[model samples]
Target chain A: MSHADPVLEIRNVAKQYGQITALTGVNIQMFAGEIVALLGDNGAGKSTLMNIMCGALPPSSGEVLVRGEPITSLHHAQEMGIGMVYQDLALAHHLTVAENMFLGRELRSSGLAGTLGWLDSARMDRKATEEIAHLGISTLRDVRMPVRLLSGGQRQVAAIARALMWSKAALLLDEPTAALGPKQVALVLETIKTIAAKGMAVCLIAHDIPSVLAIADRLIILRRGRIVRTLPAAGQTVTSVVSMMVGENDDAAAA
Target chain B: MDRFRHPLLGGNTLWVLGLDVLLVIIFQLASANGAFLNPINVQAILTTYSQVMMLVIAQTMLLGAAQIDLSQGATAVLASVVAGTVLVSMSAGGDPGPHITLPVLFLVTIVVGLLAGVINGVLVGWLRINSLVATLGTLGIYLGTAQVITNGENLYGVPLSIQSAFGSVYLWRVPLSTLLAAVVVAVVWIQFRRGSFGTHTIAIGSSEKAAIRNGIDTRWHMVKLYSVAGALCGIAGAFDLARFTTTDIGGHGNDALAAISGAVIGGTSLFGGKVYFFGALLGALLALILQSGLVILRFPPFYQVIAIGFILILAVAIDSFRNRNEMR
Candidate 1:
């Protein structure tokens, strides 16, 4: 937390899809340059919270603010610098790495927007190649290779690279290491820490307690659409977090 | 074995291209005693490929995103009919009607294409209908409307000047259709190969949820894609009328089906997220070459249908296999 103000503020937000209450009255703040982990059981509304923040879904009630201003429109959310990378990576498998890097906003030569269209492939490729390298994913080869050919870790790296390149305000990653191998998971965790260290805020949604504990500066525990507790990760154990997550009384658990 | 199973091309494009070349060669050999390799024959081959190639490219854009417009051929048929009807009805039995000038007719084609496209887009994109079913239903509706407009009669009295602009027009030795196809394919290849919409469409096709989460308006892109497809089909229909001089109902359905086969054969995955315009061009040329060769060789005309059927089956099978492999 700094004098710069919180990057995101969720004020009493609730989301419901028909009869299913995905989230209820969630108030949370994410500061710049901090990695916040959102942990919950399957139905505890972690995704719902993240989705509302990312503007994928609107909150049934309450409001979300970026930089002290409320996010009123989808365009505002995008311009406010909130970026989300879903678990599936949302990458076009058939497209090359550089192409996927600029999925929505591509670099084009000036005249190319008109009749004589030309893509500054050299420029895009060079920047993408440099960014991927700067992100410590240098082992991957062939920027022109389709993403489908990349390993799960490489794909994650490419996706993170995409978010980092396009997003400056805040980045939200949903279970980034959910299906990755142990080594790849560690690589992703390191990337998360690096992102936070770069002065950009990050929200990581995670299921595995140990993995979340390893990198998170703070943890948000959601149980049944409500924020059960929020705590610093200074010396918390998985067992204590789990017990609190499941609503165990402190005295009863001590006994 | 591991290398073979990897997602990258394990000789699939090569295999398909080889088959395409082989079919072309075999057809040439059967027809004209393989003299189809001569320059004039080659020109003919290229000309036939030119007109439908634009439609193929347009269709490929939609198909690559996992959508099909059954009404595409109908849109083309109706555009031609509209032009003919407007021209003939305005005329006093001899002079071409002013209501159907070339520019106006062209404008009408574009507007109709866009309106028809909006209908398809609303049904599939907003209303959330299965694309194939919705497009098919619209296909029948459009065809019926075309019949109603024409009363089962072919509109043939298009002015020579109107027809000549698109029909008799040529750039050097190349037909306008061929040149247009080349330009379209080139432009689309560059746009999609290295442009924004290309990436957006692929992202949407690859994973709609992911695209939505990433703040890409997937629905709008889909509607735009359908609209573009309609526009292309409309233009092609205009050209077809110029080339054929009449809008007959029976043979046009095969054009849409052929375009799908061409798209699939071109390495644009039916499962979505991949588009190869060059491959689609090659696919269209291959299919057309085989059909033309069959006609020359005096084989059963239905052989074209069987060949296309086989191509479709093979393409679908390969797509499913590739999808399963990717899942693994």
Candidate 2:
């Protein structure tokens, strides 16, 4: 409702896996510089939606529009600048933070008629270090240390960092705080806030009601492969959101 | 030593070192003579190891990236024949062709080897064929092609000048070919240790699904990796043919198996992820030493095969345990 011009618009999207319907007539709009959390139970179409948006899966019907244009090709996905970070973090455990940050988008120096390509490690390291500092992740001190040496929280942060470094448009994070301890969850929430402040749109999927309340600017609840409700953060409580998420009547009226 | 705890050089490095120590001890025990430790014999061992070591080095790079090129040995054999036949035919038919020039011949042979590798890459990387099956198929294709070229005829009296430069020449008692092997090992080690290639390679092998989700261009990376392996085999083939002074038909039947065994013994894991180039170097050396020890022990050539099999199995077992530990 607060959107001026929606950054992403999913118009009547539907997806099916064999005989099972994963998502049905799901419609949502995401705006820039906002943290929108999708709340759902297990297999409630939360992952299906993110997968469709991230180019991991194709919708059976309808369209996904970025800046009012539908995505139809791989180049469209890359050009739209949407990035995804899965629950596994996808941070190469063998690679250093700098290497992971610039994994795909490596900058190489021009050699002999522009034929010899060499990676510019110095520049990549400097940029990765700056990004790490900006995230307020002090535990990740050595940019050269492999992600295997990193804690769960640091690995999550690094995955996000890779996304931010590669693409500037939108980030779709799936279960970003799942399996994290309380302290790590709080740190991730802070990182989410910082990401939004940088004018980047974030779509976070979570099952935890308290976590959504902590970081989300708005919440979209999906039940049985359909959008049930969209609520703003102002004047919202966990009780109301939980009832809405589970398809139960809100207690606000009786209270 | 705990001084280094890299994914590549962890407990696996210790395993490689232990194997080396064991091989040396076995060599000493089997020989029971001063000849085994003689510098001349050592140099001879180095010379012999240098040839297979080239193939092992290439195998290590591919294996590092969670790939294996079964056709590398066959490709080397084919290159040797191609270089020898083309040069001999050109010289005999007169024109002292550019193809016979050392640099040009070397480049052409490598290019031929690269073409063979590219075939495997296209099948495995582009067509998304299973690497083992794809390379296995090409292994037969390349070996068959080599046999056809030679037609069971050995090419002798190869350019003596070429032989002297690459084969007979030595710098302060060290063969130039051995120096070349040293350079290859050093370069690969730096790439794996100081560069970012190993990281990406290991990640690909560790879990292809994970690598794809992380935004890696897995297919393209694999193609490039296979090409590198091919180029190295091409070079090795050219060198082996030039040095051996004759192009023997079906000379590389055991090259692939030997290189793979050497890599495993050097602590490279077949399940992918993790590469130890120097360990591969040590592994190749151990294999060579064992062969020499067998000769000194007056064992048959068939026994050497059994020894290699045992070492390969033992090394793979140790590597698997190390892999499980690291995963935890």
Candidate 3:
């Protein structure tokens, strides 16, 4: 890695809810300019691992570090440059796309107006427009259009763009392509690739094997609350990945 | 669909405003002998409209965040009672300390309102009680508290001159209360259009979970919203004493419903995240016009209450229809 330090690192992280161990002994690193895909079946700890990494849920043990500095809370995680697009997008559908992008971190006008909490709407709209353009996303035309009006893929792009604006080290996408059409899926993959080329570490948690194979540079597969494999994705196929993910094929071969 | 813009407020304000004007014109034309347009009737409507406008302003913000406060009227009644009782004891009832009485009375009234609001906020925001139920419970408690304070009798001995000064005075042929209401509306509208609190308020109402995930302290913010509503009710209570110079302990029972009717009739959404302050003003005005015009046309006064119920239902129906069709 160019920086010699991973953008994000989770070391010996484990999570438990009562007697249910959601994740155990999870260790992962994401270097800048890298795309890491987290794959697993339902209840396999993919979501738990991602939640801990994003600092949305605390791990029972271990630490989440951004640029080697431990993150304390979700707010701290964000402050230290960990951004995430939730599975549901967590967008305020009644607000415009630009407003959602800058929600809770709005840019206010200078001087007294700012102190009084008056927003610089022009500046925010301009900033959002500039960010969208800088990301090279052409699907969304209006920043002022409420998120409720955007297509699913466009909402995904907007959420990604929002995360990108505040994130300096890593972007964690939870099922970014879930429920999108094939063409939209391709668009999202291309967008992820574009973001990775910009040197942002991307951790993609997705269920679609082929889509994961096509976009992810590395695969980390988990089963029954523990990671089973960490393999490079340069020459992996959908069938091979699927067998490893389900874990039954390995048992059959052993038998 | 394309018309929605502005970061803080949006939606069809002009459409609602237009309807308000049409309602006024129809009233002006239909009332027997144009009585609705007569200066005295007009004056009476403007005064009562201004009086309830305080609660309307409060209810607008509450409903804009998808919250409801059924105790605004009760809160006002209690505030007025406490403040009036204190003023009478302090001033010995003659003009009630002319210079200091009104200000102090108003302050005490508002603080009580604010305290009542904080209780509601704590229940809803901290304890996670449903807002409607919380406020409804507080309504009973607050009204009961006022009744207990006065032994179910309206408190007398308030200075009559308060009515002459703050309640009935006219600066430019309009009721002094009307002018004061205008100032309040103007100040609040500007803030709603440009302030962070206003933006965040809508954000929370639009989707509380989304707002919380985005780093907004939805729970804490809810406390502030309810507090503001309560404080406004305090001011309305002060107005109650100012206008009538007596505690209307039993009179303002319908204030909450009237205010909600006005706010919803305006463009503010009952589901939260949408607010148009001017639209709310117009909505309240429409209700006033409907009630007053019916009176002039010699319709039974009970029919006015029925009209209000019908109009409130119609407004919600329209809002629901628009919401269902707009969202995919």
Candidate 4:
């Protein structure tokens, strides 16, 4: 494995909600062209950490550095080429796929027509089609279909596509396959591979150990708001990872 | 398939249009000597409700954004009162009343109207007050201020030349005020249908949390939307002054209800995110036609109020049913 500079780094981030500590002194780094799976059991502060990294929630202490420069606010993160896809997939159901893809950043006509606020919908639709094709998303047959009509997996694909459209440095996906069926999960896994192959940093949060081992380069397991173990995925089995996650050697106990 | 879902035929605009045609047929069939279909009567009907149509357009924007403004009529009346007070003061030195130009009065009225709108916007958008309660409070404040200014009496003595210019000017047989309202509606329609502002408004109304995550400034956009509604009401106030040649506080009692009902009947939902401008216009015309038809049929004026109330209830019930299906 080549040792390269990290694209994103979270330094000693901590979060407190009144009397409870959701996360404390959490540190992580993401290098380009690799997928790092964030694994933890329930209430391990995985979501709180993700939210702080995505700029959705402010860390009570510590800072996030993108390409070695500190950033603040979700808008600032986006400007530095960091995109996040939430678990809910924030897609407007009434809008079409192309419209959702270009939401908040629509193209307008040139010169006087543009000045009059005439949307260049033809150009947007064409670009959306090209991008979806390039991304190898085949489930979305018609870009003009309202997002509400799309299957859950297709919606997930579209959300990822939208994030990738703006994110150049890092993509943070929160449980991208949590709600998908077996086939859809396989499809999303392939897309994640394609994303890493494109030289973008990918941070995936998932609970499925076999899928994570099959795809991730490194797995960092969290237990009660701290990174308990960082293991290379090349030779790790599900049994060994589960033992580490639960903080006990079940095989040793069985022997 | 897209054509089948075209907003014109398949959406709420269709019901408003159907109601409009039905009202016209009913009126024409009941009128002696086809009086309701007479061009003169049609012109009168069109002219009388032109100002209310403008207010309906304003209400549509608010409702589409999932906000409501009950203070629009009162805001317009306050704007007119401001203009009328100015003109009346200027005319006190002479027998023919004020010679203040229409442009100047319009400018003053629009400023006052916009100020009122901004205040409401600030309360509801910035302070995060519920829009219904915010506008309701402002409605009382604006109306009370107007009553204080006029001392609960009508303000008259507006220059006749100003009235003729705005109220009587016609192009190709249509009143200039109606034409002006049509232009406003057309511009608003384009903004709502094709502009970024409209897109953001719909997104905010659909799911404000989603819109916020996408980095849309929902609160600032709400302020702008309410301000625009206020500005439209100001323009309507200017037209109302021209049409009546007086600021009659009592005369505006039914305007808020009419505008809201018109917007609802035209298919603008009480729940935000969908707006049909043409539907609203047709809805306003439908109400006006029903009132006029009842008068011609020799029914007491009180029956007109009952008819309008019935229409409002029916339209809202149907809209909620349709929305439920769409959600499913």
Candidate 5:
């Protein structure tokens, strides 16, 4: 992992709101084929960190790199193979799954028909099925079905699939399992593991500690705008992770 | 399934079509002299409503993007007035051949109409004003501007040949004007069905934030849509001039409402994210067929208005109930 450059890196990043300091002196590096869960309590700057990493918010100071190259905008970050799936998932329910998947970059027919903006829907539907199938997501059987008809877990999977299909390097998800049942949490967690195992970096801000712990290879704990600990997830109890997240571990260290 | 379900089969479209067919049948049977089905009367209805369909198509396109254009009628009126003024000045001595004059007239009218849309797009999309208020405001400005151009008098003295060639001429016993409208409608209908532009529009209407997050420049898309809708209204205005050989500024007070009602009553949701153009045709037809049938049945002319008001309410009630059931 050390031999290859990190897929995403945040160095000495800081953000301030007028007189208030939201985040300061943050550093993080995510390598390929890794699932890192961002564990934080309320007001722990996880959202701020996620926003900065996704280029939605700019850090007051420091560098963010994707594949050793700097990102100028959120669109640029997407271009540089960094994808973000928001907590809401942001899928258009009115469109078919395949249509939503290829919303902005739809395949067009060749030559003048393409110039006239004719869509190549057959290719798009086939490609959507292929991508979802490639990720081993089993529930989505019909690409032509509108997204509104899908269950919560299926929609979540489709949203993640869209992000992964577009971004080649890293996936940043804000609360992937925040609004799901036990079964859907497991499904999404399993999907994240499959994504990581396929040589992609997955960083997720997780409110549900156990679900993240079940699949995340590493846990990055954030407290009061700073990352207090970066620890391996293996054998870390929810109680321990929660304590670290709330700064009890820092108090213990200072003592 | 509810949102992008085939616009043709969804909501009240089939019922509206059935109502239209039933109305035509009753009108034909009830007319004193087959007046409702008479070729001349049918041709008049076809030519008249075909123009109204242009506005319905325009309004439907705007509604697809979660936008509205109250100025569609005003734009059409202003376009015809301005184009008529230009045509009168150019043809003062001898009418230039219809080939040269008609195209120019159409071009000027469409351009004026396009400019009206750009103003609305800028206000709503770039300035970020609420579309309802913005279009309502433009409706007044555009209509007032047309009123000022003609000073409360309709423009006249347009070239007669323009009307002769396109307005009165019918091929295969059908009005040429209606066929032209048909061709335009068919092209736009197919584009909305198969083009990226249509999906982009519906996407924006679905969730503007979602569309923007997916890298759609929704503001620019708004501008393009309003401009396109405006151009259609312009074409409608040009056809109006070609048919009447004059401007009718006072004649189109109900056009915007009619178009919006046509779109809504047809199947395109007032809330947006649906492009039911054919449903809109049926919706607009509901009024035209009712009115013409009333005329042939010897009912009062204004009775059609009250009847249309009732039908509009009935259409909305049915749609709301169906939506609730579907949700369940």
Candidate 6:
């Protein structure tokens, strides 16, 4: 496939734990304004690939280029505008929504108070409100509400909002709908489309085939640490995707 | 309604305050002619526990960050011993022989405390030692060092002015040390409520992996927190020297227990990620009142220990119940 420029490019990425190889010779490229669904079973290397891309785990041998520049270290990846939303939704539940949105990168007050580590809560609240609105999330009424009080869908939105807030190049989401109800899943899926529509690269890792086929522009399938197929989402049915995922003939699996 | 439930000044502080008021009333009725309400007795209670209040503030921050320091009281004693020994030796060497002033002595004691805190911080924060075991081991070392320094005797001859200033001097009938403790509490309360440091600390306590992913230097922050705890202990040591005019080596036996219990009672969870400064202050006051009130009512002193032990268990049980509710 040809694109103007790729936002994230992984070339021949591999991961090994001593004698066991978790991933081998994986190649993938994510472009701007596209939703690429990473599909795989339990032992698949989807997590390993995502980890390497986000700098959480180093690849045994590979080159990861962000916006055409090589990057090392997770902090550098963040500085290069790559962000991830973990499956567990890494949020401090006791802190307010605004606080969680700006967890480590808090806005300090201007001048002396700021230098002394005072957070500018008003500005944070206002900014958080604007971002939530930008994402079309209306369920979260109060920016100052602690995250623990939020519903599952709202928490997922907040987590996605956090990743999108800092990620200028690409956003990686791992199992955005694993524990979510059907309604929440729809909300998250819609949010992901909105994020991609804003001209940012979105990589979604999920198992549910119908939902993945519903929102994904492209589908990348993984099996036994290898990319088995990369196909266009258009004109594809769940049966074909499942057959590809489980490496079985479509007619046999259906029978 | 939202304002009432505001996280900072809301449910926890109110509960602790209500408990404090109830205790005061009970003590008033239990004492002959309401002796527990006597101004002198009240002031004594506030002043006597002021040191523990200071220590509790430090413990609150430590416990909120999912760590504990059992060596705080021992560190205080070590700081006082180091400062007092230097002063005594300098004075014993006769006129103009490196005499140490109170300010210098105070500075020395604080430095000693900071050093001790750094050691604990490095062990727990950098070395990744289990906080309880590390601090417990340090507690023995610190206490042993203090004893060895003074040969099991008190280091006396603290300047009379220092004693009067920290002990007798009262601002509007409140001891200076108590006022100082209030200031420390206010400062800590503000940091816990409004500062990024406090937010980062709670975040670390909540999930270290999440905090790291969010770009927080968890180990560095942990080290800094332990160092701050040590510095506070040192300040408390200075106050101890000034109040009693001596560094009584073994006088701090119950301090760590009282401080930890008070912090726990104030809603600083052992599981971490939550702290209540005002609640902790009230918890310290409650312990002090219970002890002195029992004395006034002629109950055996051992009852104070029993009460404190019971309160610790009760606090933990309540915390676990609250956590369960949160999970649901």
By lDDT, the best candidate is 5
Superposition TM-score, candidate 1 onto the true structure: 0.86
**lDDT per residue (tens digit) for residues B157-232 in model 3:** 8876667667777877788878877887777767766877777887888888889999898888889988888988
Considering the two chains of model 4, state its CAPRI-style docking category: acceptable
- Please, what is the whole-model Cα lDDT of each candidate in the order they appear? 0.76, 0.77, 0.85, 0.82, 0.87, 0.83
- lDDT over C-alpha atoms for residue B171 of model 4: 80
**What number of clashing residue pairs does each candidate have, in the order they appear?**
0, 0, 0, 0, 0, 0
Give candidate 4 misplaced runs (Cα > 4 Å).
Answer: A1-3, A178-187, A207-215, A233-255, B1-10, B93-100
True-contact fraction in model 6 equals 0.48
Tell me model 1's lDDT, rounded to 2 decimals. Answer: 0.76
Clashing residue pairs in candidate 1 are none
Name the runs in model 1 displaced over 4 angstroms.
Answer: A1-7, A10-29, A55-67, A112-119, A139-142, A250-255, B1-21, B31-48, B90-110, B162-176, B318-328
* iRMSD (1 decimal) for each model: 5.5, 4.3, 2.5, 2.7, 2.7, 3.0
Candidate 1 per-residue C-alpha lDDT over B227-309 given as tens digits, one digit per residue, 9 for 90 to 100: 87887777776666666667666657877777877878767777677776656666767677777777777888788878878
The complex in candidate 6 yields a DockQ of: 0.52
- Lowest lDDT block of 10, candidate 1 chain B: B1-10
Position A57, candidate 1: lDDT: 79
Candidate 3 lDDT over A1-255, as tens digits, reads 458788999999999999998888999989999999999889999888888899988999999999889999888999999999999988887788888899998888899998877889888888999999988999987998988788899989999999999988899999999999998998889899999999999998998888998888999999998999999998999888888889977799799
Q: On residues A92-122, what C-alpha lDDT tens digit does candidate 5 reach at each position?
A: 8778989989989989978887787798888
Q: Write the per-residue lDDT of candidate 1 for residues A201-251, one digit (tens) a residue.
A: 899898788998999999999999999889998799999888877778655
Cα distance off (Å), candidate 2, residue A202: 2.1
**Which CAPRI quality tier does the interface of model 3 achieve?**
medium
TM-score of chain A of each: 0.92, 0.90, 0.96, 0.93, 0.96, 0.95
Error of 5 at A213 (Å): 1.5
**How many Å off is the CA of A107 in candidate 6?**
1.2
Instruction: Name the better of 2 and 6 by TM-score.
Output: 6
lDDT of 4 at A131: 82
lDDT of 4 at A37: 90
TM-score of each: 0.86, 0.85, 0.95, 0.91, 0.96, 0.94
**Which one wins by lDDT: 2 or 6?**
6
